[model samples]
Target: MRSTFDFSPLFRSSVGFDRMLNALEAANRMAPAENWPPYDIVKSGEDDYRIVMAVAGFSEKELTITHEQNMLIVTSEKADEDEKQYLHRGIPSQAFERRFELADYVKVTAAKLVDGLLTIDLKREIPEEMKPHRIEITDETAPRQGNMHQIEAEAAA
Candidate 1:
């Protein structure tokens, strides 16, 4: 009987911020809250992302979008009715709650409900210091573009 160890790097780091690490680990281990509304995450551009949820039969008035901590939550609830009068209700028009994890600098740009889909745009604002930068090379150490020796040899030939 042999025992296996996790041996993950997360345990080897300094214990200064162990509480945050534990919270992150717990968040990652936990499954999604609910799957009541089908959604898609699409990368619109380099620093832009869009989350589209298929909320067919849900009205814009019933839906709510809110941000808590680093998570974006979208919840919806239908209006109360005295009597149910639906012969065939194929569309999913029930209460739903959806959550999305947002990056450090990501912010909600806009949200719109068109037809039956609810689209929420997110923009990641990267600081100038964090963005990738190109190093400028001086003429002295720059790599030669062509084979000058071969050109000289061809000229001699």
Candidate 2:
């Protein structure tokens, strides 16, 4: 039993959450998630992550990883093989494409394929301006000469 959601009320009261709201609507509209080509996302460090995908029969040349803005795309295409009779077919050969939405400042650092597993490494490189810095607390009697704006104000006076 699935229930629908109405976001009109949120739109009326919210100010700057358009992107989050759109993501929610997109998720609601998407089909049930597929389980093929199992993958795992692990947080290896404070700002590092890894994605490991089991691609049993895919080669390094057959896989492609792309990073665009805050999105990571992984696609695979199996090489064409001669028509051969087989007793049983269990492995999936059809092409597939998967997308992962990454957070701001997150970037793909490296990717490798080994033992039928595709591993991707990611790191978050926050800009200096975005990082927090300590601001010294000064006593009321302390001179405010350290501020350039204050110096300029005094020069104007």
Candidate 3:
């Protein structure tokens, strides 16, 4: 485990609870089950994402990707066959289980394995109400609009 600090000054802070910040901080603590298989995470778009893992010598049936309660779980296991024999075994047969903490609006969009890479895609949809709304301000209203009352009221509610 690693130690991280919260250096968020009170000046010019956000309005409500910082769930995304917490999620990002929590992400630093997440570690792979083992170092056997390396992986990569790529963001394709605002909501689209991809998680690619180097999975050599493992068939599609041997790998698994699942999402549970906003957490993405990946695991790979290969079975031993008596019919096959190997003169020298350089590749690893060990299994691995990795857990990734997904954001609030994030979801697994799709998953596919190709060319020894297990790719898992994700999507994030910001709720309609959660999206920012534009507030029109007139000359008169702009004079009295510098108060934090609205933010406080929203937090209280």
Candidate 4:
């Protein structure tokens, strides 16, 4: 059985989180999850991450990785198979597409296919202006030189 959730209450209290909420809702509505092409996501460093997927029968040419804004899309379409009789087919060669929603400033750094494993590296590069910085607190009673002109103008009035 499938389950559903309501986010109306969250929308009423939260601001600037529409994208995150929508992503969550879309995830919930997605078709029953498929286990094909098993994958793993690992945090290698404080701001670095890696996504490793098992693409047994796929080659570099058959796989594609794309980043659009905050969405990362990975797709694979196997080439036409040759007419060869197979006693048993265990590995699947069907085309598949996978998507991941990245947080702000998260970017794909590199991708490599080694020994049937596709490893994609990601790094979160926050702009210097957006980084948090400490602000020095000053006494309220202290005279401020920066606003002396404004104070003088008001006094003159």
The candidate that achieves the highest lDDT relative to the unseen native structure: 4
> On a 0 to 100 scale, what is the lDDT of residue 127 in model 3?
95
Q: Is candidate 1 or candidate 3 better by TM-score?
A: 1
Model 2 steric clash pairs: none
Clashes of each: 0, 0, 0, 0
What RMSD does each model have against the real structure?
10.5, 6.2, 11.8, 5.0
> TM-score ranking from best to worst?
4, 2, 1, 3
- Per-residue CA lDDT of candidate 4, range 17-87, in tens? 99989988998898877887899999999999999999988999999999999989999988998899999
Off by over 4 Å in 4: 136-141, 146-157
- The true-versus-predicted C-alpha distance at residue 51 of model 1, in Å, is 0.5
Worst 10 residues of 3 by lDDT: 148-157
For model 1, the local distance difference test gives 0.81
Q: Lowest summed-lDDT stretch of 10 residues in model 2?
A: 148-157
- Model 1, residue 56: distance off in Å is 1.2
In angstroms, the error of model 4 at 89 is 0.3
Give all candidates' CA lDDT scores.
Answer: 0.81, 0.89, 0.79, 0.92
Backbone clashes in model 1, listed as residue pairs: none
User: 2 or 4: which has the higher lDDT?
Assistant: 4
For model 1 the local lDDT of residue 99 reads 76
Question: Per-candidate TM vs. native?
Answer: 0.66, 0.80, 0.66, 0.85
